[model samples]
Each structure stands twice: as C-alpha cells, then as structure tokens.
Target: MPPDPADDREAGTVFLPKFDDRGLLTAIAVDAKNSEILMVAFMNEDALAATRASGAAHFWSRSRQSLWKKGETSGNILRVREILVDCDQDALILRCDPAGPACHTGARSCFYRRLEGEALVRVKT
Candidate 1:
C-alpha cells in the first residue's frame, strides 16, 4: 500500500521530495531580499542532496546530463536561505542570496525579457 501524503508533511522532521518520472524536481530560485525570481532549474536526487548538505544551489543539467553547482564557473553562486516544497511535493522554491548576475547573459534574472504586444522587451536593470 502507498503511504499517506501527510506522512511527508510532519512538522520539523520529514523531507520527502517528489521527483518526477525522470527523477528530477523543478526548482525555482528567487532572491532572498526582494523576491526576484532568479532562475529555474532541475534537481535530481543527488543534486538535491548536495544542495541540502552544502547550502548551495545545485542542479541537474538535462543537456549536459550531469550535476552542476550553480555559479561554479561564473562566480555567481547562490547561497540558499530556505527551501520550500510545494503542496504536492513535486517542485521546490529556493530562496537564495545571489552573489552576482543570475543569468548567463549577465542579466540580473533569467526572466529579464518580457512579452509586450508581440515583441520581446528587455527590462532595464
């Protein structure tokens, strides 16, 4: 028999993340100070474990098929402040303090472009 979902939600104890069929969970990182969404990434079991153990943001790259620590190369590391699991436990919110630009393009956020009247407008930083 399957276990009750409430078992995973017991206060101050359990942390049962619900990974998808591909064994990855959608993780959204946001700025701890202003609540600006930084980026969206996927986390495998290993990546999730690493993040919890190290307090750093780690993700599984679908294209690279490997684990990656955020900002490992660009010095834009995300220091995780809190991790909130969705009600369904299928996704996670990572509140973090970013050291530098969150986007690879040197933008503050990956969501810097917005759709406006059939055009993609770049929001000024």
Candidate 2:
C-alpha cells in the first residue's frame, strides 16, 4: 500500500522534506533580482534548520563533511529571500540576495561556463 497523503503531501500544511540516503536535500540558489542561478549545494537537517533560523544560506560540505555557512571565508554571504521545495520535497530552490560573487572563482555565479558545441566557454560579463 502507498503511504498516507499526510506522509507524502498535505501534512496539515506543514513543510516536510524527503532527504536522500545521506540525509541531505539538494539546494539550488538563485539571484533574487535577476533569477540567475548562483550555485548548487546540499543541506542536511542541521544545515536546513540553521538556514531557517538565520535567514542565511547554510550547506553541508561533502568535501569537508561539515556544516558550512555561505560566505564564511570570502564574505560573499547569500541572504535567503525565499525557499521553494520540489513537489516530492527532495530538493529546494532558494532565492537569495548575494553580497558578492557566488563562485569561489570570483564570478557572480558558479555557472559562468557554458558548453559551446563540445568545448566549454567562459561567459563574458
């Protein structure tokens, strides 16, 4: 039998997320003003809760195996304006206002490269 609707959807209007095997949900950040995709990351329960509490973007670093606050090192903080979860609740889209570049490469977004035929091209600002 399938799970109850409450377990899958309605749930009395409360938000319920379906995390992956790693207890992480995919998070996509976009620029609130321009709708430009900023970056993609993962959020564990702790990271999600922290982001909700602080109104800032928090992520689980698979490389560091730790919780990370966006812009902790570079001061390019992402202030979350809104968050929308996927229908199945396994992923989230965060609309945010960024203080500076979102990419570690000093680009406005991590998606600064585009595929041109078979070659990767850097998008000119």
Candidate 3:
C-alpha cells in the first residue's frame, strides 16, 4: 500500500494525524515477517516521520511527551522493513526486523500479561 498522504516530511522528521489535539495516535502496530505481532506503539506524525526516516521503531510517548526510538537505549532497535496502512487510512501495520527482544523486560514479546480468572497475570514464570 502507499504511504500515508498526510505523512509530510520536514526537518528530518515525520508528521502524522492528530485529531483536534486529542493526542491519541490512531494508527500503529509492529509485526514480523511471519505476521507475529512483535509490538505495538502509538505514533504521532512526528513519530511516523522519524520511523520512516530512520527505519527504526519510533513512537510518541504520550506520558513523556517525547519521541522514543524503540531499543534506542536498550540495544533492541527494530529495523523497519515496511509500513502498511489499513483501509480507511486510520491504522498501520509495521513490518520490521527486530534486533533483539521487543519488550523492555527482555522478553521476546510485549504480551507478557495474561489473564488468570479475572485478574491480570504477569508471566514471569
């Protein structure tokens, strides 16, 4: 699919859609070649631009209000292979070559949380 049209490039950064300053990124996902969801992230247009320019997983940290390149400090950077947008242009599928574990805790994936009964269970064992 074609890259997002609103995805403008300037000053070495990317810009994505922000609806009425909602600050909620509506499009994003990470996947491997085999279609496993390696990770997911919310992207501001800037994050999308940075990701496109750098070929790394860059995300807009809503809590931190900054750009965070995945595995930047942890040495787990994802080499983005391609960016896919779903129909309606509101969602994204990122194809990447993960350098190492995707999760910050050193797990292969971020889906470490599981459901046990009604409580959220962390899979550490």
Q: Who wins the TM-score comparison?
A: 2
Which of the two candidates, 1 or 3, achieves a greater TM-score against the reference? Answer: 1
- lDDT per residue as tens, model 1, 1-125: 99776766643366777788999999999999999999999999999999999999999999999999999999999999999888767799999999999999999999999999999999986
Across 1-125, the per-residue lDDT of candidate 3 in tens digits comes to 89655544212144334432645455444556676676777887778889889888788887898989998898998888888765434467788888888888787778778998999888762
List all candidate RMSDs to the true structure.
Answer: 2.2, 2.1, 7.0
Q: After TM-score superposition, what is the CA distance of residue 80 in candidate 1 from its true location, in Å? A: 0.3
Q: Give the TM-score of each candidate.
A: 0.90, 0.91, 0.73
Candidate numbers sorted by TM-score from highest down: 2, 1, 3
lDDT values of the candidates?
0.93, 0.93, 0.72
Candidate 3 structure lDDT: 0.72
Per candidate, the number of residue pairs that clash is: 0, 0, 4
lDDT of 2 by residue, 1-125 (tens): 97686565544456888889989999999999989999999999999999999999999999999999999999999999999888778899999999999999999999999899999999975
**For candidate 1, what's the RMSD?**
2.2
lDDT for 16 (candidate 1): 73
Model 3 alpha-carbon drift over 4 Å, by segment: 1-28, 120-125
